[model samples]
Target: MAKKAAVLMLILFVASLLAGCWNRKELNELGIAVAAGVDMEEGGRYRLTVQVVDPGQVASQQGGNGGAPATLYTSEGDTIFEAARRITQISPRKIYFSHLRLFLIGESLAKRGIGQMLDLLSRDHEFRTDFYLVVTKGTTALGTLKIMTPLEPVPANKLFSSLETSEENWSPSLSVTLDELIDNLTSQGKHPVLTGLVITGDPQMGQTKKNIANIYTPTQLQYSGLAVFKKDKLIGWLDEKESRGYHQIHKGVKSSVVFIPCPEGGKVAVEYIRGKTNVKGKVVQGQPRIDIQVEIEGNIGAVGCKKLDITDTATIAKLEKEVEARIIDFVEETIDKAQTKYRVDIFGFGEVVRRADPKAWKAMKNNWDEEYFTHLPVAIRADFVIRRIGTISDSFLNQTKE
Candidate 1:
């Protein structure tokens, strides 16, 4: 009987503690941030824009049609922390960041510096590390958060899907998360790249506010090229073609399509199936010299040659050589521009030199950006193999021998 009485007291004690929590807030009392954008404001201040979810509408989706989707709020301050605090001025309820799916930085802000903006994200305990980070080109960071995506019920979900698709089709367009960005910033060997976005529209529509579109993408955010950075500051932008070449040389480029001009003066599209780049770094006279070998195999998708037969070994071999030459030209041009014009090691060649010849890198580590990368000797060789000619073996224009 004494044991039974003790057990009854324990149940009452648990019930009392569970019923009286003062920190609890009603669901409608908080504004959940779906996405965040950071940009450089005038007078050396920073601007923060947040896309807040409407819980009432989001939760009632099963029975009712989606309403207003998400609302965007903007705030400006000297720092990211201060900017976030200023958001409370416009926000009716407490701003919660537990559901943030994407973070965008304007090109101007990225060029100025992202380390300061990202500091708050890393130190904050409420933010998750999986949020996608993108660089907005020709658009303000705040503007990127305002555009609504079609098909997706929520704008944040659409942004997430855009990044995911880039990874599967064009690997150079791989998505970078908060955790990965932080890691690249801390690592001395490599510099992180972010996807670029732009706003486009019909000028006559008069609804220019909804014109935001990632240019590389026909529909949504595009992870097309690398945003070359000197440490944390963005140096320059790489075009889509240049970005693909950079991916082939330094980053992970699983599959990509290249349009090579045929002998008959039209376009021949070849889609890559397997690609591998091998780099060899050698030290000579206290300088770094690197050799890059790219091997790719793909099948021909279309042929514009009027007289050439794809099944012919000679014709196929010549086509393969021409494709290899085009890839080499593209790769060399990108590297030359990056090294000579931008002077940033966004291609990660510095990492290769460091890993290959530690002694040379150690001696040249202090002045790598200025001295080493500028004068570093780089040799690139490309080899392409046409594995298959699709379903039709010969070109339609080829004359058949009876």
Candidate 2:
């Protein structure tokens, strides 16, 4: 009977060891940060802003009119870590970062240098590499975060979802994650580009709850162009068309619409369903040459021209040629801008050189962007195929004669 009691006691002790909470934190004790923003301040200080979700407001079924879905907290210190820890002085609960979805850097901070910021983020155990990285254009990170969005109650969620949708359907904007940005910074051949965020309406009004209650918002957050970076520093911004052109060369385009003008009149809109780009580098007698081959297949989405016949093979072929030319133009324009304007190799051309000729790349690695890449001759070739012309073979405008 004593031996049985001993065995049962041992079992209970083992079970107790396995069952208790090891490092559990209560929900009330945590200030769950869903989004964070960093801006540069005077005297070389770092300003950190975090958006902490209010569980009661966010979960409320009354459309969350109780209050803002998230509260903004700001802190300042010499370093990001210090600034983050200082947030506790203002907040009642401990700031938690496990739920972070978006990270924004102000234009001023990006221009000064984000290498140190990135280093802190990578070393921190609380941060995950999945969050989206964005740059605020013509505004401060705090200012950008303060603006409330109408469609999405949570501003962080709005930014995350908008970036995902834009990258999938639009060619101009590119989504950069924390991991991808770090990879680009560490890589010798490539540079990083982040989607730009802008506040369209009155900045002050965006902070108030009335901004969302009105039929039309007085202020709004918009995803602007792409912010180009050389290493970890912001160099410049690319316009909509230029950004799309950059995507064409780097194979960042997934699905986008292209409008081509018809020979007679009006225009035809083609929706690119699938596309791929292959960049090859060759060195001959010490001169580097690049060949970019693009394959695109799309369907006609809208026919604005009345005279164009969708059923005719010749008409389709002509439309295909126009699309091919447009694709080539996009690639070539981007290449020219990267070479002459930015003088930055955002296309990973240096990597292509490394793959094609490792010996030559080793010799040119140091001066690749400045000396070799800027002067490299590029050839762009696009092959575009039209698969279908929507549900109707011909536009109703053509049927007016019938």
List TM-scores for all candidates, in order: 0.84, 0.93
lDDT of 1 by residue, 50-149 (tens): 9888766666756246356678889889888898999899899888997899888888899899998788898898898988888988778776666655
Report lDDT (Cα) of residue 256, candidate 2. 98
Winner by lDDT: 2
lDDT of 1: 0.77
Q: Write the per-residue lDDT of candidate 2 for residues 1-402, one digit (tens) a residue.
A: 999999999999999999979999999999999999999986889999999988888788785667888899999999999999999899999999988999999999999999999999999998999999999999999998898887788899999999889888988877788898998888888888888999998999998988998899989888888888998899998888888888887764669999998777888999999988888998888777899888988999999888888899999998899888888887787778888999998888888888898888889989989999899999888899999888888788877874
> Could you list the CA RMSD of all candidates, in the order they appear?
4.7, 2.8
- Pairs clashing in candidate 2? none
Each prediction's whole-model lDDT (CA): 0.77, 0.89
Q: What is the lDDT of residue 215 in candidate 2?
A: 94
